[model samples]
Target: MLPGRTWTRLLVCLTCGGVACSDDSQGGHARAHYQETDHPVAGTLEPRSTWRWCYVHRRTV
Candidate 1:
C-alpha cells in the first residue's frame, strides 16, 4: 500500500499472483500488469468480495 492509501480496490493476477490496485485507484496497476504481462485474469483481493475479471474478454468471469 502507498503512503496514505487504503487497499480498497486491490487485485491479484490469477496467472502470476501479482498484486496491484484497481483502475479506480491511484496507479491503475492491475490494468497495467495485465497489459505488460498479457496475463488474462485477475481477482478482487477484498475480504468478502469474490470476483474475477478477464482482461482478454473484458468482462467478469
Candidate 2:
C-alpha cells in the first residue's frame, strides 16, 4: 500500500462519519468490515458514570 493512497482513505473516513465505513481499495483482495451496536452491553455490573454507554464497532481488516 502506498502512503498517498493510505492517507487518502484516511481523509475520506475522517470527512465522512467514522461510525461506518467500507474499504474496497484492495481490489477484492482485502476489505474492511464493521459491526455496530446501538448501545453498550454489559454482562454483569454496570458502571456508575453518566457517560458509561456508548456505540461500539468491531472491524476486520
For each candidate, C-alpha RMSD in Å? 1.8, 13.4
Looking at model 2, residue 33 earns an lDDT score of 19
Residues 1-61 of candidate 2 have per-residue lDDT tens digits of 5444432122112222332212333321112311222332211122443221122433211
Name the lDDT value of residue 8 in candidate 1.
52
Please report, as a residue range, the 10-residue window in candidate 1 with the lowest summed lDDT. 1-10
* Best candidate (score: lDDT): 1
> TM-score of the candidate numbered 1?
0.82
Q: Output candidate 2 Cα RMSD.
A: 13.4
Give the whole-model CA lDDT for all candidates, comma-separated. Answer: 0.89, 0.24
In candidate 1, how many Å is residue 53 off? 0.7
On TM-score, the leading prediction is 1
For model 1 the local lDDT of residue 26 reads 79
